[model samples]
Every structure is written in C-alpha cells, then in structure tokens.
Target: MNFFKNIIDKFAGKPVDWDELEEALIRSDIGVPMTLRILKTLRERDAWSWVTANDIAEVARDEIGRVLPINPPPIRPLPAHPKVILIVGVNGTGKTTSAAKLAHFFKTRRHTVLLAAADTFRAAAIEQLGVWAERIGVEMIRGQYNADPAALCYEAYEAADKHNVAFLICDTAGRLHTKSNLMGELAKVKRSLSKHDPNAPHEILLVVDATTGSNALAQAKQFHEAIGLTGLIVTKLDGSGKGGVVVAIQDELGIPTRFVGTGEKLENFAEFDGRDFVRNML
Candidate 1:
C-alpha cells in the first residue's frame, strides 16, 4: 500500500521531472493510459512549473478515485432462489481459496451458503473446497475428476434450491486465458447455470493476483470478453503493494473489484472501498 511512497521519496526535494514522473507512474503498474492521464493533468496545472512529489501523489490519487466506484453494490441473495457466484481465474490465481473465503464471508453474516466444487479438472481442487466447507460448517456438492463442470454446476443449483441456500458459489477450474477451448468450457458452465434461473450465475467474479500487475489486466480482458465478468476478487495484496491493478482493471475494462485478499487467512478477505484504497496508497 505504501508503494506510492517510493515515488514521493524520489522527488521529495526537487521539481518534478516530467520524464521521471511518467516512468515512475508507469512502473507502478497502474497501466499506460492511467499513467498518461495523470501526467497530462500535472502538465496542465496552474502550478506546473513547481509541482512537488506530494502534488504528484495527490493528482494520482484523485485520478484513480475518479475511475473507481466509491461503493460497488454488495452481492445479495435472491428472494425465490439462491444467488450463484462463479469464481474464475487463470492458473495459480487462488480461485478455489477465494471461493472458500467468499463462502466464509457470507456464512459469518449468518446466511446459508453452499459450495460447488466445479473445478473437476483437478482432483485436489475438489478436496480443497471440501476442507473449507467442513471448516465453515457448510454443505458442498462435488463431482469426480474430469467430470463435465457445466453438468456439475447444474446439479449444484438443484441442491441449493432444495435446501433453500442463500448463496451457491462455484469454484471453476483454472485455465490459461489464451486457450479458446478452456474459455468456451467456462461459457458452457455459465449457460448450464442459467438453465435453473435465466440469471442463475448472478455474479461472475475473476480472481487475480495483485503481484502479477499488468498481466492481471490482460487476463481480466480475456475472461470478461469470453463469458462476461461482473466483478473481480483481487488477491495477494498484503505484500506486493501492487494494488494498482485494481484501479487499472476498473479504469480500462470498467470491471469493478468487489473484493480483496490482503493475506492468506480467510479474514484477510474483505469488500473493496475506493476511498479507503486511495487514502492508503500513500
């Protein structure tokens, strides 16, 4: 979160060097478009000749604030059916864990939550969510390895409806964003879920590693284009101080980040707040 401090320190006692400022902003992984926007604002300022490091930080925070939503609406359960949330991401992005954390998030609020181990491509994935389900004291529907994930999710919806569950979170198998076959399979899952309720998968959330920086933005673009993403779950933000991807994705794709994982523990996960995020950057 203090990553912006580096930029502030760099120009602490000197007039802002346009080239150095641009490089610093770009290197922060806020994306080229956002970096350029910040620079342009600084150049057009009334005090452009004597802008300080603090001024740079203020402008950056203001621009980022403008791009991000102050408060994205929270996910709420439907009245007649369970609200389905599909957790998706590229390999090694912590999709399963985030799904579990999300379940825990709702359960803590005293809402009935059901988990679907739809990542049938990986045997360990099913077991992993099972462990969390047990710990969270919730029911989980799982299928065998290599099973059709679309079919598995369809069945999970029926189970959720039968038990009057408030939320059904499906943790889908991780795949490379570049693979059309894998992405198509994801689209199939969305379609299968919709069979129960036209909008069965009420939320499609993409989990991304904040440390991956600009690559996270690219992944969001591909996933959003493939099946349409409703929001994002950004992870591993406790250490990297690379939360700029949250702003970058929101700015570029107009996909709001709904949640963030600050650490490995379940409690580390929480809803995203634009104002708090901008305030903590320095």
Candidate 2:
C-alpha cells in the first residue's frame, strides 16, 4: 500500500481532492472507465467525506475482488488421459517461461505431465522448453524448424498417452493480435488438435505481461475474439506493472486469471489471488 500511502499523504486533509485521487488511480494503470466507476461508487456513499485514503484503498480492493473471480472451475475429469493445456500469447510476454512454470506447478502437485513445443517459429523456443522439460524430469515432444505445429500436437498427445501423463502443456508460437492470417493459422492448430480427441485443447490459456497495461487489455479482447480464452496467466507483475490490468482484463473479457508470474525463478509463479494482487499494488 506504499503507493497509495504516498498519494494519501499528498491529499491529506485537503478539501475534496477527487481529481487528485482519480489521477493517482489512473497513474497506477487502472483504466479510465474503471477508475471513474470506482470514484463514482465512493462518492455515492453517505460517509464519503469522512472516508480516509486507507479506507478508499480498501474499497478499491473489495471492488476489484468482486469483479475478479478466484478458483474458477477446474479442468474437468474426462474419459481421456492427459488433460491438454494450450498456452498462448504474444512473444515477449514470457509465454514460454510461463509454460515451463506451469509444468513445474503441475509436476509438484504429483500430476504426470508432459510439454509439447508446438512453436516452430523459433528454434530457441523449442530448445528452451526442452531444457525445462528435462529439469522437471518430464518428457517433451517437438518438431523440426517450421514443421506443422498441429501435426506436432497430435504426436505429443500420442506420446503423452504412452506415459499416462495427466497434463500436456502446449507452447504455441507468439502472434500479433493484428495479424488476421496468424489468428486464422491458430484456428487451424485448434482444429488439428481435435483430431486426437474431440475436446483435446480443453484449456486455452492466454499469457499476458501485466506491465503492458491497457494495451494488454486490447490484446486480450482481440485474442478472445479469435480463439475463446478459458483463463489467463499474467506475467511481469513483480516489476513495474501495477497489476490493475488483470482486473481490467477480467472486467472486459469475463476471463479469470488462473496464474501469475512474479519473478524469473521457476517457483516465482503461483495461482492468482485478487486480495494479494490488490494489496501488493496499493
């Protein structure tokens, strides 16, 4: 709450500092629409004049939590083995790293897991995921450079079946939301995965860099429009990111954040908590 404390110090005992409060929030990366709504809500209260900055902070936290859903429905148990988790996002958002972290997360839970490097766009991606797979003591499958990613997904599923893996995480190539052709290719990949099981890619998780702020929300909207998103993995929150983007994404897209990347280490990731997120940001 240090950031909010600084703002409060500036406005302490000042007569009706509504503009300053709104400015502070907007600077914190809370979108304008949501910031205005929050201020309006606070102004409606009977004790608006008496509310302290800390009290306002609590109100913000509660409001964000209300819109952010925690513990969304889990991956349903199915007749098929190896629940498929497809992780997608733009390149630099740490999508590959998050995929590795997720693999580590599930492995620690004692779930037999495997990783598939469906990203043929770059050799480094395939190699990086392979290293993580080896370190996690889980097997992985990849294809030659520019190999058909959908074809690789099917082969990975077959390999997962042999290992009786409980979870198969697929790391796809990063794509710009502006590229309709790339989005179309993603649909083809989805259709290809279905060849193995009608519902193979049960979870389409979008990894986002929280530091991207409002732009991240735009990307989420575009991606959701292209391929429905089941959940989100928000990254780069341990740095300069304000963490409000997660709330905004949830508010705009109705997609719950499933996990967050806090640091560079494998253990720096964890499931999303609305209270913890807001408290850390404030």
Strongest candidate by lDDT: 1
Q: After superposing candidate 2 on the true structure, give the runs of residues whose Cα lies further than 4 Å from its correct spot.
A: 1-6, 46-51, 75-79, 239-241
Worst lDDT run of 10 residues, candidate 1, spans 46-55
Off by over 4 Å in 1: 46-48
Each candidate: what lDDT? 0.92, 0.81
Give the number of colliding residue pairs in candidate 2. Answer: 1
**Residue 277 error for model 1, in Å?**
0.3
lDDT of 2 by residue, 1-282 (tens): 233456656656654478878888777666677788788877876254565666677677777767866566665435558788998998799999999999999888877888999999975889999999998888889899899888898889889877788898999999998899888877887888788888878899999988787888888898899988999998977756467778777777788888988899999988887666666756
Residue 89 of candidate 2: its Cα lDDT?
90
List, in order, the clash count of every candidate structure.
0, 1
lDDT of 1 by residue, 115-163 (tens): 9999998758889999999988999999999999999999999999999
lDDT of 2 at 135: 88
Error (Å) of candidate 1 at residue 166 is 0.6
